[model samples]
Target: MPVTPSDIVKFIESRPGRPLSAREIAEGLRISPSQRKKFYRLLESLATEGLVAHLKGDRYSLPRKQNLVTGTISVHRDGYGFVSPREGQGPDVFVPARFLREVMHGDEVVVRVERGGRPGKPEGRLVRVEKRAHTTLVGLYEQGRKFGSVHPADPRLNQPIFVPAGQELGARGGEVVLVAIDAYPNEFRNAEGHIVQVLGDPSDPAVEILSIIHKHGLSHEFPDDVLAEADFLPEEVQPGDLEQREDLRDLPFVTIDGETAKDFDDAVCLRREEGGTSHLWVAIADVGHYVKEGSLLDQEAYLRGTSVYFPGQVIPMLPERLSNGICSLNPQVDRLTLVAEIVFDAKARRQSSRFYPAVIRSRARLTYTEVHEMVEKQLAETIERYVDLYPMLTEMLALSEGLTAMRRQRGSLDFDLPEAEIILGVRGEPENIIKAERTKAHRLIEEFMLAANEAVAFFLGQRDIPLLYRVHEPPDLAKLQAFQQFIAFFNYGLNLEAEGVDPRALQELLAQVEGKPEERTINQVLLRSMKQAFYAPDNVGHFGLAAEHYCHFTSPIRRYPDLQVHRVLRQAWRAGGLAEQERNRLADRLPEMGEHTSRTERRAMEAEREIVELKKCQFMAERVGEAFAGYITGVQPFGLFVELKEFFVEGLVHLTSLSDDFYTYEEDRHRLVGQYRRRIFQVGNEVEVLVQNVSVERREIDFTLVDLAAQQTTAQESPKGRRAQGKSKKR
Candidate 1:
């Protein structure tokens, strides 16, 4: 038999702690002369993937055997970076600034771990870059006497791209432009690139948002083939489309969403039975029916993975013809859907669930504000407007309340953190920033969706069907321990002797700090200590939700994983169960599908966050020198992050700006202390601050204390003041 990759790996393993050349490896396997070229290529490919390390003299060995590690490098704006291993579990290897001269952020590279480094963590130097993350970047073009350079919009990309005279594309000095890198940077030379697109002034709000879109590499426009396919789809559901779908047109179903929502993907109907049981029907648009597997539309949707929603714009996975037209569950229109019909007891505990295809005509489209007024406030005007649907709405409210109680009883975490809502002008400029409201009606819809998702996940998991689950693994022990230490400052404790702590323990701690002064700060820190939720093939369970089986089955119009779940459910339901062949096929592909969707979801979130910060900076630019009441939300070695009470905008108060006294950071206590005066700056400390500077391009806002002396006087009498004085006296 011909030699394979496994054969090569085995041969290399045989000679442990020794690097061997390709010729020797091939000779030991009795390779022919004709196979020499192919053999060398195979070895090179393995090295590129970090499976093997290529040392001097063209010899190869396993990466671990040579103290070499491979992974993507995430660079901080300060120039240092860390390499997270691609295929194993361990601490990330830290790479100092001097050792990162030849590599950029997000580049895949091999690192050689030094013998002596930071305690309990490995430090390394970049050996070779295996892959580059960016070939093109968006930046501000700065013209020089002889040539021009593009300063990257992303702060992690510290090096400037050198653009020669003729390659400037007629861009002005301060214009935002896109540049294609022809040569990457090294120790001896700067990166070289040519301007490709001039994207107007950076000060323009539209240009600022557009620059972020390009920086994240988000696909905003659909390809011609995908658009053509979307156009070919029917504008409305046809007669044949309802062949096997249950007709639920007479049901009083309604869609409750934001006033600005254009694409409605889910609708709900709840019925109260005589036996004190509730039957809930959640109907999700049947997007899988139109965007078949391997079709142009499906390919594009898979590539996008999830729709990216900006402040006033959205980059949808499918073309608008489908996302907002035929697939949207609009009121008074017959739309094809996949229904999750679940039965619940008086306590809102799920009794049984079934999935089926259906066709439904929604009775009305309601906004969250209206629903809140009708349900929570009991407004006569709002209830009179939807008089026919009020009884069902009341029943829905009861079911939602029961479900909320059940989840809370099971230790489901509700962070209840405030989010900023950016009010924009007609020209897309931010006019104001306010805290987003989360009313009972919002929770009602959220509870219904969560119930549907859990029901679907449990249904599929019981049958051992292959699908992607929304998994949130338990927090790392080290992180949990550190969190315990931090919360101890507030006289809070957790049982951390065991390997895994119960979710209810965390739930109780949150309850203890609910209305305390340090509530937001503690909540933020505990949230950071938990692991991020992601989609995976394995059923690891969701730690935050306290669910044994969980998956994304709602909102197929925006999320790809939900569409895949729908397809699998329909196939399995029609055939009574999935066959062995079908199961194997799905099992083989779901892992990769999960990974891609998770990555795209994170990318979209980052883009959304970046745009919001940019807009906040723009809004604050006009308010410089104005004082506002605020509180410190975060404390680090370098500075304090203060959030204004009026606008919900956060700005950094740098250490250098505190010229009155030199302060040292207390990492364990999360505070800053003065050397002589003994003033304390800690999390949750209220103060007055003035906006000093705003850089929209960098998405930064700088603040300074309005009156440091008065603040210090006020802090001198607080509980923290006593501790600071006691520590100073001890010193």
Candidate 2:
């Protein structure tokens, strides 16, 4: 007999508030004995159709509330978890520790929501494990006489997995190993696994970097086939290919970049036209000419979103033959390129533009220092001092500054944050850290690339073409409001109305903090308050660039998103038709691509951070009890993070080290105030600290107070208090 919707409803209604077992429900409904065994199957279908709810203990019931969603598990080290839906529009759900089952982080699980008012917070439990996100984890091997276990190094992986004796990891007590999860954790037990690769001892510095690469799941090398394919490519450019592209063989252009840069992707040429207009030509490497779509090279490039650059090494997405030799716009060499020719009006507005494939001949390659000196000193010294093409270089700088001013007038958010460069000595050992200052040479190249990228995006959109744009949506209103409250202490407040906030406001705020001590601290906070950029087929526009249409059409040698954009642009140009069906297909696929590429980019960034942190640890390994001046970078209930001015190394000054009095953290005012002495540890305050200890094993640096007298004298310089929008009253 066929079961009707009313029949399923009636069966579920019978359970009411009780946890009815599948068998019990069948018996209560007086289902036939032959069909009794098939009763649970019907209940499963009913659960899928939202007709009934599946609770713990193999029980069934009617759903009692709204916003009750089932999603996968993503656990955190802090014992809390977030549940992102298997399908639909609900803000990511949160589950507290008490309700979590044996499910590990990144596990696909069904969750039952608990009561909550805020849409951001969702409490739930693990009803079932649908799938496992990663079956492998990097960890350390440990033994307990007869039994053995793999202690995971990834903090998010909370529980350890068991290993059998026969599959002995060949790892000593402290050795790192990669463990493969054979079976997942259930209600009352940990997962089962066996060690796959037994990485050497943890004390070795090389092992530390290797572990970082593995922990983040980043590839360190290309495949054999990929290398073979690269090796077979032509060593030099042929004359035949040049015939097809526009001959810019006589045009004098220059390649400007860092002294260490090998893969030159762009070359610029600038000229002043009649009517005081500027003629700008930006020639970029046309990688699509050789690396066709759906090829092995393309697949590999897509997987690796961007090149991974470490201290002394780089894992490039494209082969060296192409990235460093053939496609590179080296001086005195002919290279195939995609050129953007634009005529800028006297006002620096892009009046007319065209894109075409071309072969470019570069006359000279100039380093940033060489060009900067030429512009700064007006080429006073000998021209034979490796300073070439001073006139052309000066013209390029003028055009770049003009374009920049035009962008600023159009509401571009120009956030200039400090970037640190690690100074490495012999055999890859850290010597010091220096801040990387941006010169006019750097800005000149940047502004030109931005102009070209914007033009490509507009050209594609005009054709109604499908493209993966780098989009940055507006900030979360609630988070922005929270940031607003904190800024009010400075007699300042952000425009909370969604439509009122503009890039100009942020630029104005940044301009105000130019040389102030609070510049770094406040800039860091403002950066965190903005939304992140990601790859997507839909054009939400980039908030940071202030561009209505913006995509990465440059840097195909490094970024995978740019390569994809390159392929789309080429197809649109050749076919002169919009791929509507392909757009629909990619639209379905792009969201997932966006999520993955974003996650990988984050992973790579984290890997870079870990490498730098380890180097910092290594630098301070032997400096215990040394005193140096530093600025307070962070403040908390437990301690303060102070960054030294001399070395740029940051270490913690725990609350216990402050022997004067008990201190409490004030979150809103961004300070730590002593209960008895009234001493304050505020952000941007300078103080002297002694390096107390350095733990290479833990990758942590610790510090203690050095000049208590100076601290007391400087304590009187604290800023006066305002109405304090986000501050709390003293307890």
Candidate 3:
């Protein structure tokens, strides 16, 4: 057998506490001279993975034997950091500011774990830096007398990059620029870098969004070769493409999406069968048909991973020629697609499912608002406008209701947190901010997509095919215990002594807290208590969805994992089943694919969220000194985070601005209490506040109490507090 990582690991483990050199390891394993280079590379790979450690004198040993732990360091804005070990389930090792003087955030490092530290947590000091996270960073350029420096846009970096006089790239102060690092920071000096790209003025909205795009390392533009490949694709589906495709042009397939949506990836059609059965056809755009594996387009799509959507703009995964042109299932167009034909019984229980390539002509393109009016509001004008699609729309509604009931019965947790919707003007400035509404029509489409995804996942899983599964493992026990303690303050409870907490119990808890004052707070806390869902080759099942098998089979145009699923399904269907060699190839490739796509997905989310927060700050900047009724959504040592009642915006009220009395943070109660007056400000409490300050560059908003004097007087007079004992502490 070839020299595998496992073989090397076994050899190392055989001689406990004895480190071996590369030559010694190769000689002991009988590795031929031809395999020497491969062996060295594999050994280095093992070191990077934290499987082994490189000691002084070029010897290798298991990390644990040398009291070393390897992991990435994530630094807080406050100068403290934590190292999450690459191969353990233990708590992260906390590193103080003094020990992190030589390393930047997101660097891979080996640390020497010590016994004493914070209670119940490990502490560590950096042994060495193994890898750097960034060679290029986006920042605001600043000019000094001798040389220029760039202030990193990401707060976690927290260090200024020095630029020599000649390397400014003609960038003036206040301009946003991308810097390439020439020398990393050490205990003695700051990092040094040269400006490569001068992005425009920071005050401009376009430049502001671009800054975030570059900060997150997102690709905003496609390469020439990828674009050339996309442009070569047929603008319309060719006749030869229909050779084994089932033609569903006669069916009344209509796509329902948002009014502003341009790329429609899925269309739905429902047909009633005898004996109270229903046939559902979900056709997803056939992106895999044009972007062959290992092609330029496919490589680009794999790199981009998923489309990043900001307000009024999108950084799409594929070029527009494919994403918006041929691959999109546009209305009244002959589009190629991969269809999931599912048969369901009267109770919405899936009876059977089949997958195949198909051609579909969407009868009409309808918005969620239009569908809502026709089905829920029963509006005559809207129903009359698309009368041909109205019947199918109603049938879809009925089927979706059945599916929703089935999913709920099986214990899926549904969160009702309102998302902020930013309405922008023609110039891309925020016109208004409001809560996004989720009408029945939205849930109708959501239910159909969920059903289709589950069906496809079950089909692929049964045949033991290798694909990326949307896996959500069970929550960590410690987190759940802490959550149980938190909910106890509101008199809500969950049983934890059981082997595993069922999703149904959590669902029931949500139902109990519905419409209560602490509903959103508890919901948000429980969500935080759960582990994040990620794409993986192994099937752990999705906990939030209460699914036994689930994967992303819809939205291939925007998501690379969905496109991967489509390719695997099509290949298996054509070949009657994947051959052993093909299966092995896919099995080897899928783990890395899962890791890359998951990472890109997180990067996209962070970019999208940062832009939205920036826009919110800008919107609030125009309303300084304005008072708004809000609720205290979070309480911390430094401040209270309050969300506005009228607008979906959150701002911080620093404790220093309270002004009336000295306040103390009560962690267990999740509240801030006044020491002298006995006044309490807790999560879910209503408060009125004025917009004190807004920093667009920092993406921060500050708030102050509107009437602190009156509130203090009321607190002193209330039966819950003792009479005023002394003068209040003044800021």
Candidate 4:
């Protein structure tokens, strides 16, 4: 039976001192959800009549000045926390450390929100911990008298744990270990816990990186079910399956990727047509062939959302048997693929496209370096390795060049940011970190893949099919305005005209500042101004690529969205495709899938960055008190962030260490300045600094300012004198 206004009033009156939110009350009474607005109106009517007392924070309790709300406790590193009420009803109630009921970060808790001294701002005391965010945590294990304690790696957790010596789980001092929170102690001093597993010593090369994975709750190993499912996959393709796909065996297609890349998911072939036209075919691995929906492999892939790529290792979403074997487009192997066959005019305007399943035989496997060298210099030895692919490679280069021109004409923003490559030694220690330069070969493959992605998105959109699209929305007007203001320091102003702007303007700005010292900082700011690209069922279009439509149609083995796209395309092409029943079923599912994939991708990115940061800390562990030239990337109340010119590693110059001045934070200006001396530290300023200290536990690099007099003396001297001053001093 539907709830009535009278019933709501009666229910509220029956329970004394029972505080409930309007939405919560509606949910409990089984009212028509859309009628929640009217339900709230009824509650307001009752409140106006003085039957119930409305709390200052819009919470309706009984006549008393008490209310109960359920919210998640977000603990700060300083120990104080805020309980964020559900549905944004109440202002975040600040909970002091003493008032906290042993709740940690991300724990959902029931809180009593009542007036303290302030009228608008209310105080909350946690009544109960409704849900613990996590059961396992990564931390350091310390031995004590007859017992051991675990200090959590992620400092956001407000509580520490104590484990008996018998349940220490063999964790050694200074070693990172996984601990299970068995019980929440009555006192906040110590939490009851037991060690589940000891990760490894922090000094170990990859231990910090692995611990970051555990800390972020990402899986490092494939589940047993997924592995078992992978083991059953066929090593070789059967002739019957090959018969169903288009025979592209005769085409000279090639796979181009990093030299270290083992799983080749995309292969391409291109040719010039009459009247300056071009024909291109992108063959992507048909992963959905083996990993059926509801299968263990599929379930695991969906959960992972994407492959996790570390410096020297990759935790693949699918097991190696599939990712590195059958689905991989290895040279000379006949593999099943969903190919996007496109026809374009010489100017690189897409004429038409058709999606089909094909049996492709890659004639050669080419590395990015070899392909790049062959394209630019006609490296004979490299060309001979794939003689048949030379013509196709030439065609791909030409078509890709033309396609990129078209995209640029359409306002595509191309920022050539240098990527870091870590070289690991035999024992997994990082030998060196170098920037990986991009070349034409890489661009050619990238452009080809982008075209295919756009084509797939367009094709799917034409059918009005719901699928995961790589959507990049236009930048927020306010953020763009702020970015324009920031660039004025470099005398570079953004022309966000009355007609508004697009990605091309940003690209032009990047080009204008290419070789300048401010390029990196400006590029970062421009990127920040733009909205993030995410997976979505709605096709709002890609702002960065300047495409009306875009989707991840390649790299299915690594990305779950690509795999999902492949599945949708396959279902559409086979059996007269995407039946009404199937479409209806996916209508509600696609949005949720997009949201999950976007969230998981963000978490994976955070985990990846944290590992890299730890490695960087490890690399510079022995280089304290060393000096290097660096550009200021960020400035805050605490310190100035300096990005090293050579290594691209960022470190902080704490305000306390800048002894020449009393620094104050200017939020609007994005800088810190000294009040008395007026010394300025702003983004994009180049300065020399010493690596004063490296904090392994905090993953921080602290730097002190270089003496101005010494810097001027070094500059006044010749190159030889500067070289002498550059001599290394041991820590």
Q: Which one wins on lDDT?
A: 1
Worst 10 residues of 2 by lDDT: 719-728
Candidate 3, after superposition: displacement of residue 348 in Å? 1.1
Model 3 residue pairs with clashes: none
Ranking of all predicted structures according to lDDT, beginning with the best and ending with the worst: 1, 3, 4, 2
343, model 3: CA deviation in Å? 1.6
TM-score of each: 0.94, 0.85, 0.94, 0.83
Candidate 1 vs candidate 4: which has greater lDDT? 1
- Look at candidate 4 and tell me the lDDT of residue 199: 86
Q: What is the C-alpha lDDT of each candidate?
A: 0.91, 0.77, 0.91, 0.82
lDDT of 2: 0.77
Rank the candidate models, highest TM-score first: 1, 3, 2, 4
Model 1 TM-score, all chains together: 0.94
Put down candidate 4 lDDT per residue, 203-301, tens digits, no spaces.
Answer: 776777778888878877987878988999899888888766899999888899998999999999888877988889999999999889889899999
Writing each residue's lDDT as its tens digit, candidate 1 over 204-270 gives 8788877988998899899998898888999988999999889999999999999889999999999
The segments of candidate 4 whose C-alpha lies over 4 angstroms from its true place after superposition are 1-76, 80-101, 108-131, 184-190, 377-381, 384-387, 495-501, 663-684, 708-731
TM-score winner between candidates 2 and 3: 3
Q: Name every residue pair that clashes in candidate 4.
A: none
Cα misplacement distance, residue 456 of candidate 3 (Å): 0.4
In candidate 3, residue 416 scores what lDDT? Answer: 74
